[model samples]
Target chain A: MALVGNLRDLKLPNLIQLNCMERNSAKLTIEHAGKYGMIYFHEGQVVHAEFDPDIGEKALFRLLGLPEGKFKVENGVRAPMSTISTHWNNLLLEGLHQLDTMHASGEGKDRRLLEMFMSVKGVRRAAIITREGEIKKGDFQDDKEFALQALSFYEAEKISGLLKKEKSQFITLVTQSKRIILTEYDKDIIYLDIEAKYQLETILPFIEQVLI
Target chain B: MINRWLKEITDIAGVEGVLLVSDNGHIIEKIGTQLDQGTLEQIARRILRIITAHNLDEKSVKEIELICYNYRILAMSAKTFTIITFCGSIRALSLLRITVNVVVGHLIEDKKSMKQIGKYTGQPEIVLEKEYLDQLEIKLISKLQ
Candidate 1:
């Protein structure tokens, strides 16, 4: 009988490791997003693979990219052709490395975007916080204190409703020590601490540029 | 006297309402406000908490300006009270700040306002509860009756 289960229960990477370690000759089929991908293992070695329009290493990486799918492994199924020559261990490592690089680039983009804000004159500190209050980018001595600033925005949102006002866009707090600005950025909150010496109006236009 | 002082802020164009809250979250005085007593009280509590949290790090907060889509809310803290004003536009803030300074100055010297503020002095220590901080918005708004 073929081993079958959802990829969610048994991830593709783990499944590949299992088949290769067992030293079994089998063909593993994966169905994801209406597409079918197959990997051929020859006695503990990843000999061949195919995932439509891509075969061998390219197909393997593409398959690894899938977050969820259904997979079936049939024993004694042989590959009609072998296209991958790299060792299975090295292949898996490369695929995972590529995934990590892709994720890091996304985070890097957000960090660079914050750099754009920090570049503004008088912006002493800056951070992007998600709705759950996690700091997505930027740095602060106390993340807890910074996340609490979102409370002001939340209160303002409620107050706006009672006043029958439009949706909230941002909040600016001018304290004795510093001026703090909190604005919405793609569902996340951008917190900026500005020096009291600089007039808020003077730097607002430049800050708005980064927000947009 | 404090009411008259607060009136100067409400008199500004686009200024909707103003609330003078005591240091311990009491509504000492309010002028030209559309919010009911419940909503104002809730806001006062939140303001106190926000100020307290910021001050925990030893940073004294003197003012805060919240800008919504069509409204702006400004909170300014003085020796005795925190003044929260709801306005219709951002432009009103520049004018409000000048007017507020005048009001804060007068309150500091006025014996009557000082005595009234004394009643709420010695603010109780605020315990930062995670549950309270987490439910900042939806819970408070839902409680609005």
Candidate 2:
């Protein structure tokens, strides 16, 4: 029933304590820089969460796994150092994996990629646009065109039209440094740019089978 | 009257075709060039499924439209209907939106006319036979698969 202070001043234990003390439905929204995580408390229990993919009590247990009392609780606000750093590398890998799947499916709509990115812990905003100067999909509406222009270096329209047409579901152009993802489905086109340096060469062939 | 009306719609929208379909995916009237009735029916059914599965409610559903790019599909939806238009990689959203609005208005008018026909005739009994339903179902499923 009480409004807790900013999320940055409290830790996991204090958050749990607040849930029990209030004994009411509450939403804990953590905003660091621009990234956000929302945890839902229902009647003194953690019932839902938006950040930790694990969901429910399992996410609570993960949060509690951190060193006890390591988190500072100030005026009912819990602030843990960099939630992204705590799970940085894992999030990066997941982001890469999502990019891979999107590329493989040739379904790099900015919206779908944004959904995947939002599911991760670190990334705040992102988008994918085809090389043809069109916004495919993304989270923030305004930034979509900017990201597409940045990735394409502003020549997306001309370059995308040059790719060969095929019935393969997806058309990919791969190199040692980066990869281009594109797909045609249900009368629309999607595409993306992905860093190829860290991914296995074998991944492209696998994607071809599933996507194309 | 229906064919003439559909042609008028094509003139307004510059689309290749227009279709009148039932909620269950039956194609009642198909008009336009370079488009087969079967293909239009199949596309309609798939679009309906996409709208339903995504829980994309009416408020957020913009006009029903689809634009094809070289590598992806962009789908737009409206209440009770959808349109799938193919666009090459270079099509702009601004142009697509204008085109779709024209088509949407035509669709609304078409739906009204169909209702008026039923009311005027007093038959009000428009039912696809079981055989036609079965055939449509099979065709739709195969197209999706």
Candidate 3:
């Protein structure tokens, strides 16, 4: 029988434990938003795992951090290879610890940067959004909508990478009524909006100054 | 009128050529110098890539400017058409922008003329300038002698 449930109900560690106790050879898959990951098990021991280009312990750790997702385990599946050697219990503990450390490292810094963006003269809304269109922190009421629409700008950012002679420069989009600026802040992506008439010339220097 | 406007744009001090491409990738009209089919194709492809990457659906795109070392290309939508202009130097930057703005304004607001953007009955015609030059030449020659 396939085990199926939301990751919220059965956390990754608990799911791994369930598989381990049964000594089930299976491939467990989890998906959140648009990203997917797979873990291969040999008789209930995690032998391999992947999330895109990341593999082994790193992939496992990332998968561990997903607070909510849909997960499925197909029993009797073959393990592709052995990439994880750490015992599942110890690995889960370490992964959780690492995620906690990562969150703690970024906690206050991102809020301060968002505050900095909102302090700008023409800025009306400031947000720390992920590449996947998740707004971690925002000053706007419709932050989710803004983040979703601003995700289109990622395509622009990538395209600009191919088009710009100054590859290192950040990308900004100006339309008739609005200016959307994207920049790196506190290891997270910062997105801010200002009126179209506001000068883009002043943004970079101000951001750099505030960052310093 | 678009042909004449194209000429006006190409005549901008350092412009190399003017090409008006439709959203469908068709060249609606072309005027001026030094542009070849291959170069135009490359430019079209580059612009298309930019449009795609920017998530700008055709018809929604209002304007685009691509600046390179030797040249600058400006493209703007005019209903079903997108006008593109290529100029040679950074020296033409201000003039080019102003001219493009004027042309776009004319394209949008004054779609009245078949040969010009609008009907301007009072526009002055000055076809003969040889006499004015002749007076200047005579005065300069007299001073020299």
Candidate closest to the true structure, highest TM-score: 1
For model 3, how does the per-residue alpha-carbon lDDT over A80-129 read when each residue is reduced to its tens digit?
A: 78899888778888988877676676664565455445445566677877
Give the Å shift of residue A35 in candidate 2.
13
Q: After superposing candidate 2 on the true structure, give the runs of residues whose Cα lies further than 4 Å from its correct spot.
A: A1-212, B1-15, B33-35, B55-68, B71-81, B84-93, B106-145
Candidate 2 per-residue C-alpha lDDT over A66-136 given as tens digits, one digit per residue, 9 for 90 to 100: 22222222233333321222232343345456546655674544344344333333333335444333455
Give residue A85's lDDT in candidate 2 (0 to 100).
25
1 or 3, greater by lDDT? 1
When 2 and 3 are scored with lDDT, the better candidate is 3
Candidate 1 per-residue C-alpha lDDT over A101-195 given as tens digits, one digit per residue, 9 for 90 to 100:
76589785666566556556677888987655567787765455555566566655665666566756667776667788888777778888888
Q: Candidate 2, chain A: TM-score?
A: 0.30
TM-score of 2: 0.32
lDDT for B124 in candidate 3 is 14
Q: What is the TM-score of each candidate against the true structure?
A: 0.63, 0.32, 0.43
Question: lDDT tens digits, residues B4-109, model 3?
Answer: 7777788788787887655444455678845567556545544443333233222134555543435555666544445677666657566776787787667666
How well is each residue in B35-125 modelled by candidate 1, as lDDT tens digits?
A: 8898888778777766765665556678877666567777888755788888876565567788987888889899998898788765523
Q: What is the lDDT of every predicted structure here?
A: 0.75, 0.41, 0.60
Docking class of 1: incorrect
Q: Give the lowest summed-lDDT range of ten residues in model 3 chain A.
A: A162-171
